[model samples]
Target chain A: MKCRGLVSLLLLCAALGWVLVYSLWSIAFNPVGGSLPEQVSKAMADSGVDHPITAVLLNFRSYDTLLEIGVLVIAAIAGISMARLPSLEDPAFRTHDALLDALQRWFVPLMWLVAGYLVWAGAHQPGGAFQAGAVLAATGVLMRLGGMPMGFLQPGYLLRAGLILGFAVFLLVALVTAVVGDAFLAYPAGTAKYLILLIELFLTLSIAMVLLSLFVAAPVNDAPESQEGHQ
Target chain B: MTPDLFYAFTGLVLFITGLFGIIALQHLLRKLLAFNLMGSGTFLMLVGLAQHRNGTDPVVQALVLTGIVVAIAATALALVLIRRYYHLAGRVSLERDATDEGRP
Candidate 1:
């Protein structure tokens, strides 16, 4: 026991030492100069964009956002396909627990409201599509854990449409911009803020649906042997 | 000392802990939870990196956001695989090690 305790203490000390070294190195070697927050704030001020998060998510790296949406859609599709437990008749799946089911009943709707608020608030604050989608997905997970019927949770045609809506809107915006003699996805100078917000809103909806579907696709082991034997 | 650095460090620690959990745990659900912890950690790091001066490079934020989406997608796929594996094999882990060999 004494030996084991000594070994554990040594391990803990090593870990603390590593973290300290890494932090010190990072602080000393970071090439970026000036206060990051101040510089970022100043840059936003210069661009006349009011919200920093919006400016970061939409304006500075819009393409990355686009691809990120693609990743979400792809993951959702992949997960649903992988689970392969088609229809609710499969006996291998088990339902959620009673307490969880009751909690989910009350929590799902509230989460949706919170998600909507987060998406809307992204215009001038820290909330945005990603955060909103995460929140929305959390709600879906709650319902999923509650075993609240597959029909309500699974990704149907409407869910698929929602998943792509943001991409569609973004594509249209880009196409229109190109037609008007600007680079693709380039908002008219000064109109970027609102346009970006529009894009983010659609993206948020898409992301939320995609994430929820992914959660819903999680497989369960309650399928009966009759169904299993067929497979 | 800064908030970003502190958060980043916390995220890194979480990520490593998640990695360890994923490797150490045998339950599929537990593994999935660990994977999620790691993904969230990476996301935290990415967001922290993006919070740099010069207006928090939209590019990095966008990339990180995309990564988060992709991670969830991959996680969904993994969960599905885990469920299917459990159904077919009657277990989530590959090994019959003493820790989880008796688990149902």
Candidate 2:
């Protein structure tokens, strides 16, 4: 036992040492940096694209954002389908715990209020659709844990609408822009910020609903062992 | 040290810690948490790299933002799979017998 413990200690020390060395090397030799070529910077300056990060995400790499949204949509749909609780099974799953029941009485409304604030805050700050959605999902999880009836949640229609809302709104805005003679997804300079904010708001609501549905759909074997034995 | 350097170092530490946690933890949920930690570390690194005198790189921020969404989607799927497995098997850990395909 002593020898084994000593060996494990030595291995841990070695691993820690290696990690330290790697961290130092990575920090010192970051490959992302290079002096911007004068022509490139000049062109960017001429085009008035001041923020390189914005230019890359919004212009040079917008396709990645589009794909990411698509993935989110797919995941939400899959989660909802998997977690669909039939009306018959819903009543059987309701919780009888008094303590949980009491706590949820106060917590549910509070969570919704907070989630709304988080969604609104996303427009001008670090809070956005993702954060707000996660918060709302947590509330849903809380409700489920409290033994609230699944039928009250309106799981199907709410989820379907949410899954489509963000992408649809974003596409609609882009289409409008295109119709007005701008390139696809390119908003007029003054309106771009507002447009992005609008898209983000929808995105957050959709994301929250999707996440909540995913969490709630975590499978539980409601079937009794007697039924399984007979089968 | 510069703020950029500070953020970079913090991110590096977070990444390493998350790597260690991913390797050491037995629970799938813990592994997911570690993965998220690693992602946050990467985000920090990206943001740190973008911090410049003129301004930060919008492209990297946007890319990272997009990556965050994708990660969550993948995570949601994995969680669903985990939940399903747990429900069916009554255990989360993979057993040696299962690992050995048809040995039994």
Candidate 3:
């Protein structure tokens, strides 16, 4: 036991030491830097947002954000399908209490407000659709944890609509831009702000839905037996 | 060391720590937490690198923002999978033999 413990400790120290040395060498010798940021931020002066990060996310690097939203959607879909059968008991079945109700009343509204503000502030500040969406998703998770019925929380087709809303709008915008111009996502001059805001709004709602669905999964049942290649 | 380098080294430490935890711990939930901690460390390093003489590099900031969103999505998926595995196998650890395979 003592020998094994000493070996483990030596391994840990060696790993830490190696990481420290590598980091110091990079920081001191290489001093890594890049110019793409300054150049792009300068070139895209009319990205229609005062905030540079927002411009990059929604304007300059909108393609990446679009694909990221796609990734989120795919993950949500996969999670739902996997958890559809042979799943654990839904978190919604948990017992609720007055304390939970009080906590929801306090935190849910605050989160909603913050979500709204984050989206609105994205144009000129440090907040954006992702932050807003996360706040909303947190509320959803909170509701689920507090035992709110899934049906009441998401309703029926409305949830699905919200889930797809962001992707539809983003694709639509990209297609229209492509038809009108050479670039796929290049918005026509003087219309970037409104279009990006619209995109962000839908993205916020869809992200919230995707996240919630991923957390809760579609309620279904199958025998939770060991199956071959379950690996 | 400069503040940014200091933070970068700090991130290295944190990433290593989380990596260690993920390899050492048996519980899936704790491994998930460690993975998240590693992500947080990476984010911190990105922020540190983005810190410039004037301000942060917007490109890095944007990338990190996107990363944060993606991380949550990943976490949600991992959590659901973990929960499913736990329910199906009757244990949280990923050890193959311990997960009901020994039952007749």
Highest TM-score model number: 3
Judging by TM-score, tell me the better candidate of 1 and 2.
1
Per-prediction TM-score: 0.70, 0.67, 0.82
- lDDT (Cα, tens digit) per residue for candidate 2, span A1-231: 646865675577458757765765575457565543332345344222344443444344545655666688888678656553453226556678999999988998888788778756654445555667778778877877778875534655654777788778877877887899468876676665566667767776777666666666655554642244345
lDDT of each: 0.68, 0.64, 0.79
DockQ of 3: 0.47
Predicted candidate 3, C-alpha RMSD:
4.6
CA RMSD, predictions in order = 5.6, 6.4, 4.6
Candidate 1: where are CA atoms >4 Å away?
A1-20, A23-49, A85-113, A138-156, A178-181, A224-230, B1-8, B23-30, B40-70, B96-100
Candidate 3 runs further than 4 Å off:
A1-20, A27-37, A85-110, A147-156, A218-231, B52-54, B96-104
Give the DockQ ranking, best first. 3, 1, 2
* Window of ten residues with lowest summed lDDT in model 2 chain A: A39-48
Q: Write the per-residue lDDT of candidate 3 for residues A39-84, one digit (tens) a residue.
A: 7767666898888889999999999999999999889877876664
True interface contacts retained by model 3: 0.52
Model 2 misplaced stretches (Cα beyond 4 Å): A1-66, A84-89, A96-110, A149-155, A222-231, B2-7, B13-34, B49-66, B89-104
| Superior by lDDT: candidate 1 or candidate 3 | 3
- Candidate 1's docking class is acceptable
lDDT at A199 for candidate 3? 98
